[model samples]
Target: MLIYTGGTFGMVYDEDGSLAPFNFSLVIEKIPELQSLDLKLTVISFPDPVDSSNVDIEHWQAMAYIIKDHYEQYDAFVILHGTDTMAYTASALSFMFRGINKPIILTGAQIPIGATRSDARENLITALEIASTKNGKVPMLNEIAVYFNYYLLKGNRSQKIRSSNFAAFESENFPYLAESGVKIVFNESFMNTHDPQQKLEFYPKMDPNVVVLKIFPGITEEVVKSILNIKGLKGVVIESYGSGNIMSWRWMEELLRDAVSRGIFLYNVSQCMGGSVVQGRYETSKMLSDIGVISGHDITTEAALAKLMHLLGTERNVDIIKQKLNVSIRGELTVV
Candidate 1:
């Protein structure tokens, strides 16, 4: 089954020469080769296609419900999403579909299917093939993934690194689950596998009372205070400079402490693409750990934000939420 939420891959040139989303009813017609895959295909598309940038909590919930409703009928699922916010959606789905035993591959293209040099054909074709992979009636991959430019990456670990290149997404903290080469090579060792008997648990409650504050060299005291002290804020993901380093000012520490004291969840993640957040490894980051900030070890900011929202939405106890944030739930982080 394929779910379309609108993206460049779904667009075509209209009579006016402007790109518009093509009717999903003709999705298979656009690629007749899909018929040769020897599998029955079904597609579900949003009534109104949304630019990935405009995707929100409601959209995420809708998609989750669709999967939950039809999960029993489909062998696996593939989603066509916009590349702009595909990482965020993919991360959210990874957390939402916690124990799914079937592959849910999320894929998108840098160019439209109608374009002369489009990358859409290969992306969609390979994604469908991967989704159908099975080992004696059991799905080989049982997790959410972003398949782009011949690489299949863990959904939560992926980030879009380029806009123009076909190889736009990368999983920096982890290795590609499978590389699409002469033959799609599955790196079974690095791939996340799960028990097929585990009942899929849907975590649809995502609290959006979360914010990310990326630290800059000249970050101001007032700026920190304003964000940390924001009313009704449940969680904050601090994108601290390389290796989770922040200014070691007394006032800065005091404000962070205040947020924790107020029972607001706080997480420290690195702004760097590849390294883990070793919270106490430096004097600047030491106070963060000492003051109740949870270390998001090697977690992408996108995943950190999604995890925080998921934790805050489902767990009420401050202590339990803090513990879960530092722990790896669905391999989103490498807990130190």
Candidate 2:
């Protein structure tokens, strides 16, 4: 059965003009294509559907639990989620479920499912098909993914690149697992095969003691100092200028130096919408490299935040954390 969590794919415009999540179970009759699929589908939505922007680790945990609870009953699972945090959720689930044997396809739409030109029908139908497809005893897809704009991307590797386009998301530094067209041409070599012996487990705790500072023109050292001074700050993601450039101010250097000295995990990511963070390549960003800031490579802020939270919650080895942050644990980033 397909699980429809609250997201844009299931939202409807009310008579009063406000948009709200609808009960997807009630809309099965509206989509005639669903009947043709000949799959037994059931949807379970949150009583109050949340916007993807508001999605947090708690919601992620709940979603994981739901899937685990019904893991055996369903042939495969399709999650309808909000686009804003879909990649984050997908990334988190990649680590959360260690040995998922079934396809857990997460998908959403930019436009509402009810709209005449909405992309919801295609995305949802395709995701469901991908989830259910199998080779006798084996499922076609055995990992977490996001299906959007005719592409199935590794959930952790994707970032939303546009706000208005039907193709609103992209997986930076990674190729798509499959693209939908006249046929679903999958990159079979990239597909993950599960080990049946391993079990599904959920990591629910996420530390929120992280902060993201985006460096830009006129960003004062005082501002950096003030944020570093926040009590019990566990980690900071510095969104530096292109190629991870930052002001080499004496005060800024000292502030970062102090923060690192205090055992705060420092991460430097590029501020540009795309591209990887290249630490120590240029004079401007050399200070950051010397100050012991870990490079975040091409990870998006959304993925960075979620990854930091998960890392902080599970592990206490700072050196290991810093190393893993740069590495693509689930294809979320590319480490240079």
Give per-model CA RMSD: 1.0, 2.1
Name the top TM-score candidate.
Answer: 1
Candidate-wise lDDT, in order: 0.89, 0.83
Tens digits of per-residue lDDT for model 1, 129-222: 9888886778878899999999999999999989878989999999999988888889888776768568988889999999999888878899
Each candidate structure's TM-score, on Cα atoms with residue i matched to residue i, is: 0.98, 0.92
Candidate 1 ranges beyond 4 A from true positions: none
Model 1 vs. true fold: TM = 0.98
On residues 253-300, what C-alpha lDDT tens digit does candidate 2 reach at each position? 889999999988888877776788898889978888888988888887
Instruction: Kindly report the root-mean-square deviation of model 2 from the true structure over all alpha carbons.
Output: 2.1
State in Å the error of residue 103, model 2.
1.6
